[model samples]
Target: MKLAILPGLSLDEDELEITYILASGPGGQNVNKVATAAQLRFNAAGSPALSERIRVRVLELAGTRATRDGEIVITGRRFRSQQRNREDVIERLAELLREAAHRPAFRVATRPGRAARQRRLDGKAHRSGVKKNRKVRADD
Candidate 1:
């Protein structure tokens, strides 16, 4: 199974390493008996599916979730069933990859227009006049 990240980018299922562990929280007796939590590990840095730029972005976006060795570790315990948790982890990973795949448009620096600048100055002047009017006169 391939995880489609973007239009032309897809990650192989073999690239993902999934392991089931004991889920924490309110599961009564089933919690101790079954390993319902899914832990997924992906080597984002070493993956051939990702380009150098995207790899860097993915690692940066992963933040604390990424280990020192460039592996992204995601744990899913939201569902009681192991299959559901596995799906959840895969979905989360896909979301992260999708985010990394998108490149933000370059922001062009712009200065305020002459009219805008004038309006700002006018507002400041009006505020100054309001403050001036509030002053107690010696005659009063």
Candidate 2:
């Protein structure tokens, strides 16, 4: 099984290992006879294909996906057929990798626009003028 790679990063199928286990749900004798649930294990800590930074992010993102032994585990059983479940798992795994592969876009520092600054100054000036006008004269 294979997953669609993200735009910038490419992953080989060899990096991913999938196992199909008996699905748990209604299906009569078919449920007992066939395996439908798909379990995918990817070694993020050991994969040379991914950058160390991306690898670390992957581990962080996976969280519960990793086992005590440190293998990422993703399971799928939304579909009754093993083929469909398998595809779902692969798609999900690819998405996870794509998310990890992404780096946050650089944010450009920006100051308030000229018009915005002028507006703020205008508001302050107006407020000050109001306060000045509110002062009562001694004669009044």
Number of the top lDDT candidate: 1
TM-score (all chains, Cα) for each model: 0.93, 0.72
The positional error of residue 75 in candidate 2, measured at the CA in angstroms, is 0.3
Shift of residue 51 alpha carbon in model 2, Å: 1.4
Candidate 1 residue runs with Cα over 4 Å from true position: none
Worst 10 residues of 1 by lDDT: 1-10
lDDT per residue (tens digit) for residues 63-99 in model 1 = 9999999999999999989999999999999999999
Q: Evaluate residue 76 in candidate 1 and report its C-alpha lDDT on the 0 to 100 scale.
A: 98
Listed per model in order, the count of residue pairs whose N, CA or C atoms clash below 3 Å is 0, 0
Give the CA lDDT, 0 to 100, for residue 114 in model 2: 96
lDDT of 1 at 72: 100
Model 2 per-residue lDDT tens digits across residues 1-140: 33357665676788878899988887778888898889988887787677888888888888999766656889998888988888898788778878888889999999999999999999999999999999998987
Give the distance in Å from residue 46's predicted Cα in candidate 1 to where it truly belongs.
1.8
- Which candidate wins on TM-score? 1
**CA lDDT of 80 in candidate 2?**
88
Show the colliding residue pairs in model 2: none
